[model samples]
Target: MIHPVAVIGAGPFGLSTAAHLRARGIPVRVFGEPMVSWRDHMPEGMLLKSTPAASSIDAPQRGHNLVDYCDAAGIPRLVTDEDIIPVETFIGYGEWFQQKLVPELERVRVVSVDRKSGPGGQGGRSGGGFEIKLDSGELFTARAVVVATGLSGLAHLPVELRGAAADGPTPTGPVSHSSQHHDLSRFAGKELVVVGAGQSALETAALAAEAGAQVRVVSRGRGRVAFGAPPWEQPKLRPESPFGRAWSLWALSYYPQPYRHLPAEARHYLVRRVLGPLGAWWLRDRFEGKVGVREVARIVRAEAQDAHPVLTVQTLGGRTEELSADHVIAATGYRVGIAAMDFLGHELRTQLAVSRGTPKLGAGYRSSVPGLYFTGLPAAASYGPVMRFVCGTEFASPRLAKHLAAAHG
Candidate 1:
């Protein structure tokens, strides 16, 4: 069967896009397990930095907001817990929303997407759509494709470390990115080294410490930056208050129109400022003295020492030291470049085009390549930094749905 819209990834963005399309009476086929990456990768006892009201998946009119779900489930709406949306709870909410809203979703992996051509190199009609090949060897065609694959595909490790891993496994024992370190039980009582100073790094350090490993955090800087500090605490120029704030909180709280209206430069600036920095205040108290912190140091080289791994690190002051640990965890971050999406394949990736380091997305989130669109984090550079959060769907879904309706009609 030929579907009008095929959404890749069943995470928040994919589910949101699918639900919106279905609501508009557009036939939508969604692939990927609902909250698969979030469910599998995130650690237990972890909490989201976003508020419940701001982290919802469905539209406000639909009444499936996270607040409603928490209330029904008897989860307390405490201020202390406000910043602590459990990963499981969020995943459960996504799954619940998917089941209740977009039930036609298929749990499958999209291997590649290619444009279909017609007579005279017409390359299919405007609404002629394209074909999607699944890893299972199943083929399906759709008029449009929305990539909601989320952040799983884009991991950002240090350049030197990435290069070292490229040649083969690190000579100094096992070196892996934090995103790949899913199980901690195996490292129990082993010395573990974690790099980066962001929330992920801090959390991984805490987890490693809890696992009875000698955990040490190596970073280019030190000190804990709190997450979600009171708006008044920000610099006056970028204060949280409306009169002095660079942008209105109300405008950033939702998605779509507000983001669409933001200037490309402003959106780019926001992404660079927000996503690049590290803040670990939420877990600071729990981690102080418990997880060793090495600051102003860089991993110059990593090679195995006997069976254990040894890292030659250089500090900013030119002081060099060799540290040995059983394993190295780089909680660096994610790489947002479109090249990271392997499923897009070579031909489509070349045709999609990029702007300001992000995919050049149209108003409907469609790429230059017809029928293929991008949403979520990859679209943040165009849509605004809020696209990285769940709240983005509020605007993204409706806007994309309108485009789908227009194209399908």
Candidate 2:
């Protein structure tokens, strides 16, 4: 029971962090299924907005990137910026990465994580240690814990659509979040209304349309649905960045540590405005003419009428209209809130400080509670929007692993 570190996820962040930690001669245990979110949560036929080079999970070990996986697996490589990655390919790459770097990864879920404080308990940290309860009914102790659960419990639903059912959104209900759908073919021949203009909303609409469903997308009217330009279409003046060719994006993508120094207001604004609702360049061709996009339209009310979802929508200019659909899908995207992490025990949850429902992380993504770290979506509030993407693993994994190795020793 000399486990020094426990990683509570097996996504890109978790796998990368564990790989780095193990590389540093640190004893660690990783929990959760490999690439479960991308494989199970996101709908099939969906392509990642990130380019191939940006989608790789970084680690201390060599030959574990997406390109390496493709090369080893004898698959054709799409190395260009315009080459959009498919969800299936990404999932396969992630699994390969896990097997090569963190093969001992446990597929069980971590049910509860709580801080256990006592002297000389399991020879963890000097003062106290952490107890982790797995879904398999086994208990374990570790000196530190890293929470890299990507997008888990962070799905957001608009208030107007929440009233469609008493029990809330479901796969068979009148309203459901886009993350709940693994296949859009079920919506075929049905009248579908999708809200939001982000990649998820636009792509979900496109998939539903391709599945023979009549799809209509509703935007809040704050901005129009836009698409990222290809490398050639981008301006030549600005240098390249993982996000785009802008200096601001370049700075955000490369140096996420500086983001914490800015005023909270500025940081929050950039997070919301930088990577706003937009579609991938490849998605435009499939989405245009195939799906109906209603910008400047806001859903004011939603109700289930005769087992169907009906929405009263209003335009920015004050015009109101009602639209009825067989089902409503809220592609509103994720909202990071620490409270959504129901796996944290009450005592530990109370001790971890938070701001705006997200952990106020310090150096190395550590929460207020010592030895407890959080990354991925939960770290976005402190690390900027770059942490919202897979490329962030390059910046966070090494730093976090180094920090944990030093802290535990």
Candidate 3:
């Protein structure tokens, strides 16, 4: 009956929550390779859209921020808000945070998490805790489970391109999502079509061109792709949000707790639109002309021909255009569908109430199930859009840890 709190992920939310729980003298077990998603999925040489100050994992105690890690490790410090963070440095910083705080993080994969059957019956929620099984064949029970798995099972590829994209054992094919690539150099001397207007799609196109690929960005928007306003033009009246500055950004970033009080429709709308789509200001120099942008374009059909993709797109003014590329990269961002998380048993998934395919979280970030909780991107519907960024750990970690400590004590 010695059940510890289980944290399923070692990213910003999981690492920070476990640190706070340990600081409160609570027994906890954290799993997943530290920052595995950020390390493995993001393309090399890419820069973070978030500034240095906002790109930190929260710790209940000080001395664990990005600045402290940079200073301690003798890495060049990011001294100003204007400084853009590199992906590699952030990954290293996350490892440093994990080592210094939640060093007990297990690198093994979690196969499944199921609700243990109680004396009442299998569907009953009382008495028995969670039964967690790992890939290594080890099984453990937890008094409470915190799921902070970031966006592991949520890469979104558009249905239009799925026919040409093979997401199987060998993902090498005519189409793929941006998340699957770590090096853009693989596309060198080849025609590449990148979809979407967001940072991921735009940046990938830029990197592909820089790597000597014939790159073009195809955006579905009727308007030209946008870049963030220059620093001086960013108004001071609106404080910075995770994505950028706006009055609504100020409200959501400062008031995640109150976000639940707002109507579900309003919360969902803000999450979808606030951080809509824009390339970072620094990236425009490389992206503007080096990468061809087919704005006001939509893919009408995608098919495989000669081991490559041939796309027929509907352009603005009711014209049709056919383009060929060695591969199509869908940089469409993640969709938070709890059912997509196959690690959760069917019974557990069915038992939890849902909002727009995401788990409905209640007090202390707990899901509809009493002892199960969720955080990070999946909590955006219940918390706010801030949950999608590393900075959200500041609000989520301490709050969730304190609740778990008191509930289980």
Candidate 4:
């Protein structure tokens, strides 16, 4: 059967896309379990880095906002000066959105998507739809596709860590990325070392410390940085109000041409300056003294030593030290690459044109590959860094729905 649109990855972006498409009277088949990544990967006690107001799914009216959901549920509507929104709350909010607004989603995994041949050759018709092949061997055609498989599916671990685990069964002590960490009980009373200084790294370290493990964090940079407080200008920036402060920032910061004009070094520098050094306020009190932060150090190598792993690390003062730990946790971020997706057939994966390892997306989030489109973090480079945040759906959903409607109409 042919649907007007097929939305992949049932996270916040995918569900939002589906909701908007449905609202536009377009038929959409959404795949994957709702909030699967958030439910499985994130630690239980972790709080959201952003606020409820800033982290909302794109809805037409203000009635469905996160603030309203919290109020209806009798949960705290206003955040404490120290407390950021918890991950559990955000997940609940997502579930609430899915149940109330977007309920027509099918929990299936899409293995591959290929362009179909039409009556004419090569390029095919401009609006010709494409086919999606599912894991259950089901085939469905759609004029457009939206890829919202978020950060959960694509984690980046160190090369040495991957090689060690590849030789045999993955050891309980060998898990590298934060996405792989589920339970804290396993590391109790053990010497644990965590890498990276991002929010994930700090949170994981704190959890490990709370689990009674001897925890140490090895950071290549200075230290964990955090945002001072929920910026007062955020509420005024909602996308619904075009002339608001948020929209103005979005216009200046997210527009492609201006961002592209900045040198890569400049962009990195700006991100480090503005968004860097920011973490949840609660984290500072929990991890400050308990989690040992080793700055200006790099893990040069890692190898199994006496049935455990020992890392050769270089400190900022040009001093070399070897530290042995019972377990190592790498909170390193994700690698966005089509090569990592084994489900894609060689031909189809290669055929899809890419820009800096991400699928090149049109104005409507549709890729050069007719039916396939990519959203979320992968779209950030093209659409703007805001795409990496949940707020991006406000812009992505409506624009994508219009494209699908035009193609199917």
Candidate 5:
């Protein structure tokens, strides 16, 4: 039986993978709301840390990039490497790319994916395909599945501020991650404490302040909040890329596959540090004096006191202080792990090898479970840090599609 390949997401990795599979004449089905995470999770007025050239979703064919979309949409096309990409524009471009290349995307939720029992109910452990159930009550059987559910179940919230709430514990709780808020206007007239010094944390603090919220950033790390240096100051020898201007960035960008050969400790280290905490260069001016930042401070204890969060913090000079806020936002970023994918069956997830909670992906991004693959951030462990960004799709989409096609054929 010739079964269609399943792409379990509609983000950059999912759409690009489906497009490549279709281009190669492999039957494919893609599920999920296109750019839903970006559209609903990020705050308004946030900008991408990636430059225009590296922000395009990879498509197998020509004329399907961010620049192409800008040209067709008549927006001022970003030409240089210095242009800051707005998140809204990027979301629009993603929708455009989805329409142009993978219009058949099913904008529905995939409720569950389990290994199907075939013949005498003994095939799941052998070579039986997968049973995919959709929220709309539709079901599908696919010979192969690409689990590219990007950052869906991976938002990391620190434990201390987990229960604080400006209103109360609702759908998202009192203290929530930065990914939970799309509109910062709701934060207006509220006191918000944004934790972390990363781009998301810094930008969210800036957005919250601009939206009329009294905001302060609580960074526990010793490193000061940094912005990418001016383009003119950058050396021509290394050049610039979205991941930053460094030899390691070049190595990771051009040699992701070989990166897997390095010691697991090294690969993991690079993944955590390569594109480490820093705000976008343009956001620096707005954040410096306008937003209050607490550097060299750590939250030693936290508690909720009457619809607010009270944080006990230790400053650089061995000083303890208390800061209260109506709401606390954890900008701690995402932590990718196969176990977080609740839709994936427990048996299937357990059968796959794991590294740092992420599925240990093989060549072409396949998992230990045959015919099951993972890409994007989940692939970062085995492939390198590049897989964590949208630019990695240029390498992953075609390679994964080719492997799946060959295996199917």
Candidate 6:
């Protein structure tokens, strides 16, 4: 008898892991809407930050790449790092990958995950495996659990903007996170303020202005917004990494397993800073002349005045001023916190050894809690920044699947 493994997400990592596991003849049940984040959470006009080659979802079988999807779907294939892939195209590719590779994926949400107990159970550890509860109230057991949900519940709103309102930032409220908006066009003919200098903030500001909204983009730090050089201008001497063309990035991209051997502080610093907050080379034209930018500025105070949000900003030269908008979008980016994974039972959360709110992963990306694993952003702290991108699936999925097959076989 074989007990299936439970994959909790249907994104690139989840789909790829399930595909690899199935190839190894492992029983698997995957849950969550296919590419739901890309389809519903991201704004309509947004483009992928990753290049064409970097955006393809990994599969055990050959010919299931984005180029293959394009060939099958009759769309033009983006063949190089210079070619920009649209978010819609990427989302479609992921869904197509799901259709081809993980047809057994369940669309229900997993409400809770806990250790299976009773006969031969040691402490809260499951003797027969783990129990999974779905949103539909169905319960089942799996030999192991792999968490690959990318960026869910990890949106970070700066404390300065968060303390402004009584109810705090909400999707419908005066203040909202960039991840909360699916369409910035709803703010058309309205005053919009975007906080942070990252790709999200710049793109949101540009898109809002394009939709005819009065837009003001604020850089959260004391520095101006930045962009990568055009593809042609980039030097070709350095080896290529999934994120960019550099030695550090190349190591991170291809040699992620060794990242765990580095010092804890060094690992943490690299994860936060590498591939940090900059727009793609292609977004320059759409952003530069179209949106107003406030550089080297900080939002010192925030308050919801009546129904409108007002910000007290301090600029580089110590100048202070008030700025108000119909809505404030915080593009502060995401921080991985394992505690935010509320669907995981309290006991599992407690038993799992963690560092800085993330699972302390060993070889095969296994957490201290046996049979439980984490991937994607949650694995970045242990594996390095490469895990934050779609291309990391090439390394993470097959490796974990082989580890599981050997462990259980």
C-alpha lDDT values of all predictions: 0.71, 0.87, 0.85, 0.70, 0.83, 0.86
Scanning candidate 2 in windows of ten residues, the lowest lDDT window is: 119-128
lDDT of 3 at 172: 72
Candidate 2: Cα lDDT at 280: 87
> Which parts of model 5 are misplaced by more than 4 Å?
118-126, 163-173
Model 4 regions lying over 4 Å from their true place: 78-83, 121-128, 160-171, 222-274
Task: Point out where model 2 deviates above 4 Å.
Answer: 119-124
Best by TM-score: 2
Kindly indicate the candidate among 4 and 5 with the higher TM-score. Answer: 5
**Which candidate tops lDDT?**
2
Q: Candidate 1, residues 69-141: lDDT per residue as tens digits?
A: 7776687652332256778889878888888888888877888887766454323244346778998899877
* Candidate 5 lDDT tens digits, 1-409: 6788889998899999999999998888999999988998888888888877678888888999889999998999975767878888999999999998898999888888888877654322346689999999998888889999998989876665554543432324557778888888888898888888889999999998989999898888554677877666677888466666778788888779898788889988888888888887778888888788887557787777875678888888889899988888888888987778999988888788988888887788888877899989889989988898899999899999888777666
Misplaced by over 4 Å in model 3 are 119-126, 166-171, 222-224, 240-243
lDDT over C-alpha atoms for residue 3 of model 6: 73
**Which residue segments of model 1 deviate by more than 4 Å?**
77-83, 119-127, 163-173, 221-269
| Model 4 local distance difference test score | 0.70
Error of 3 at 259 (Å): 1.8
State every prediction's TM-score relative to the real structure.
Answer: 0.86, 0.97, 0.95, 0.86, 0.94, 0.96
RMSD of 5: 2.3
The Cα error of candidate 2 at residue 195, in Å, is: 0.5
With a 3 Å backbone cut-off (N, CA, C), the pairs that clash in candidate 4 are 225-277, 225-278, 226-277, 226-278, 226-279, 227-278, 237-246
Candidate 1's clash total is 6
